[model samples]
Target: MNPLLKKLQELTTKLDSTSETLDSFRVFHGRGKIYPGLEFVTLDYYHPVLLLTLFNQPPEHWLNENLPLLQENISQKIQTIVVQHRYAPGDPSEIVYGELPEQVFAKRGALSFHLNLAKQQNIGFFLDIEPARKWLEQQAANRRILNLFAYTCSFSVVAIAAGAEKVVNVDMSSAALNQGRANHLLNGLDKNKSQYLAENILKSWGRIKKAGPYDLVILDPPSFQKGSFDSVKDYTKLVRRLPELMPSGGLVLSCLNNPDLDDQFLLDIFNSACPQATFLFRLPAHPDFPDAESNRQLKMLVFELATG
Candidate 1:
């Protein structure tokens, strides 16, 4: 068997032996650059559906040869196989095998999140951030949280489910916030306990501050969002404001996913911007998504404010 099929078979075999409810996870992380000749491909298993995403065009015979073998090997466990072409205009997903369920969700432990499998670049949930969510599950109880760049509010959902006092979710997309609201409801949590702001986070600090003084702040911004946020130039601005948002002993879960930027990029920003804060630890990257250079992967660092 080829490397791709061998990897899929190994993953599926392991998953099939697990409990009834399978946790959504990355099946193959070719984008991590750990695998030769497949750096542009990624496969994600969102329960019944397996999504194969291609960042660049593959060899002409690649799909034709592999698709049939994939179906033959894992069709029993994975009902639908969807292929997404990211290089094409308006990244589209098409079903290569089986049928799609009317509603699709990515399940993580006791949590469930709506997935936009039909369209959209990101299918509502990020599997790689499970460690951060798991961390929030343990630390969020009785504390108020401010989630910036809160796409679909996955962090908010986990926080609320873990009995957080309150959570305010801020994002530029109202549509995503709407889905976030739905996610809260989907988890059977009280949606009213959280606030959703569909506005530019940088421009709406006053409104965001109105909901604080938060006990825990989550900074999970996009690497680059045209006209809104550019990590290189804008991260310092956000880091500088951390001191004003929370009191001493307050916790901050700051995340950066820019491959070009290392952990020091954030450490220096915090040192120069919010000198009162002290570094704690960096969250480890998900094992499945292995990068040759550790610094190129997602950086989730925790910090504590030393003074009010």
Candidate 2:
């Protein structure tokens, strides 16, 4: 047996052991957990598919050659396997095994999202933030939500399902927002109660503020989207303006995905910008994406405004 194949077999056995605990839809994070050189993800286990993302270097011939063997070892039937090279931005995924689907439907808890396996670069949802979605559902009753950088509006759908009064989803990409609309309909939620805006977030404060003061404000942004945001600088800018949009006693869910910046980085910004706001708690990362180092993990912190 090949060395890489042997390692893959061991990982598959581990995944099977915890299949029930993972809720059918789970992520097997391999970036820093199993394989240091690449980031391997099983996007969905119930209707199986694999995503092999190369973060460190160019693709190796051996990994490609042995993918079928890896596929065969798994207990469940895998629909397809997609490979993404993070180092090469414009490059398309190399389909190493089976046929690629135009779209794959994945369910997380009660909500479901549509993923474009072959066309879109991203599968369209962040699996690591599953805990936060579950948490937000608990907090959604009778609250108006402002979701900034609302890619695919996963948070919006979860909130609406939990009885949110209204939600305004703002993002630069109209295409992504359209998918968000589809996600809402997929879950049998009313699209009329939600507003979708395709505008630049920083410059569109005039438009975004009109819909506020919101009860729940969610900020989940990309770490570095070249021209739009540089998390290190702009995240603080967004935090500084929070008081203007949120009402007294309102809640803010701030998400930071930059591996370089730790949880304290966002805490410092929140404390300095809104001293009256209380740091509630940090959302725990998904068990599937466990890490030895704390900073490398995804950070999600909830803060509440001072009512008095």
Candidate 3:
């Protein structure tokens, strides 16, 4: 057996039917660089579908040789196998084996997020942020949350499901916000408890502020979004404004996925941009996604503003 197939087979044995039914998670994290020669690939088990993503072109015979063996050896519960080529011109996804359901969702506990498997990039939800979602599940009750760069609003869904008083989701994509609304409805969360704003957060502070004095602020912006956001240049601007949007004692869940920027990048921004806010703790990354360099993985840090 190929090393990748052997590793995947070992992982499959660890996931019982009960756990697979309850959550979507990373099956293999090659980008973490723990596994040799597989750094350009990552695989996710989205319940019934297995999505294999290639960040760079693999050897010509690699997939042809390994995919059939993988399909035969992986879990029986995985009915569909899809391959996404990030290095390709369109970053397309091909259904290599079986068929995708008309409606695909990534299930996490009691929450379900709508996924677009055919999309060029990002199939709606992020699996690596499960720890932060679990944290929100514990702390979200009765709190007003402001989710910036909310993407499909997975955080909002988790927060609302966990009994948050209210959640305002802000993103530049109207299409993403629409899916976010659908996610809330899918989870049977009350629409009245949530607000969706399809606007650039930097230019719409007044609208965002109008929705708050938020009790919790979630900052999980993309590393780079072409003309819109460049984390290195724009994160400080967002952090500096948090003090005005949140009240004393409010909490901030600031996250960065860029490997190039370490935890100190956020610590420095919060320390300098919002001096009143004290660094709390960093949330641990999900165990499945382990990086050789700890700092290169996703960073989820919590901060609390001091009482006036």
Candidate 4:
């Protein structure tokens, strides 16, 4: 029922030169997602980022409709879609993110959601790692939780609801935090348990530290952010400082979202950057997911201070 997805189906069916399994894919600026037929997998590692289309057996004509949208432009190199969903007998897997699937994909225990369905962008809830939120909820009681770049505050709200003494959600947009606060209310959380500020994380870490040695720290930063961050240069600065915010043996959930950056990259960054900490473990996904790696969008590191 999504117009963009419907359009994607139309374009792929009409591709001039089609392949069974497309390895090198690209996303030219367009109104929709693009991909090959359902019989194979399609992706562009260099383009925008990591657009994917993998599926079982889907309708060729239906998938073809969306191919036009994936055509590459020599100028802007970006992946058109992040990943595609295939289901329903007439379903298509060799698809992209243009139109989100109709499925509601529930958030697992101790979790809330903030996602945009049917778009070739990030999912609202990042449903891949619900276990991390559950862990936060289990540990939040009587402690302060600092959530940085707290997009929807799903982490903050769950922390507060789980009995965190207080929570401070920091980001660059108060409006976004406002939605986060609303999520707190949605879960019947106490407003007094949480606080929010909109500020650049890099520019404001000292002030954040002044806020104190929080019980828990969560950092799932974007790979490349135009407005507030540069992943390659800024990530270490941010990653290194996280330990200072936690008390001895406190918890730190450090994450990286750029699929281009592998899980090993995160492990190395945290090990070197936060020397005072010992690795806990990576979080797991909910039962609904068939592909576990998708949740690897960000590699999460759990650590407790060595000094503590």
Candidate 1 clash pair list: none
Weakest 10 consecutive residues of candidate 1 by summed lDDT? 240-249
Best of the candidates, TM-score: 1
Once fitted onto the true fold, the runs of candidate 4 whose alpha carbons sit more than 4 angstroms away are: 1-60, 63-123, 247-249, 285-287, 290-297
**For model 1, how does the per-residue alpha-carbon lDDT over 1-308 read when each residue is reduced to its tens digit?**
46678888986787678868678888888988888999989988888999999999988999998899888889476789999999988998899999999999999888899999968888999988888998999999999999999999999999999999999999999999999999999999986789999999999999998888887999999999999999999999898888778865599999999999999999999999999889999999989789888989989999988767
Model 4, span 199-308: residue lDDT tens: 89888977888876787788867777897886777778876886677655477787776656776776777778877777878765434332324543446667776554
What TM value does model 4 have?
0.62
lDDT value, residue 240 of candidate 1: 85
lDDT of each: 0.90, 0.77, 0.89, 0.60
lDDT of 3 by residue, 14-83 (tens): 6544553747778788998898899999988887888999999998898998798998787777788999
Query: How do the residues 1-308 of candidate 2 rate in per-residue lDDT, one tens digit apiece?
Result: 54345555665676667654233444345564554543543333435666666554645674656566767876555566677765566646787777776667766776788877656567788778888888899999999999999999999999999999999999999999999999999999988768999998988998999987787889998999989988997998888778888755599899999889998998899889878678989988878676767778888999998663
Q: How far out, in Å, is residue 137 in model 4?
A: 2.0
RMSD vs true structure, all candidates: 1.2, 3.2, 1.6, 12.4
Query: Ranking under lDDT, best-scoring first?
Result: 1, 3, 2, 4
Candidate 2 vs candidate 3, TM-score winner: 3
List TM-score per model, in order: 0.97, 0.87, 0.96, 0.62
**Runs off by more than 4 Å, candidate 3:** 1-3, 11-22
Better of 2 and 4 by TM-score: 2
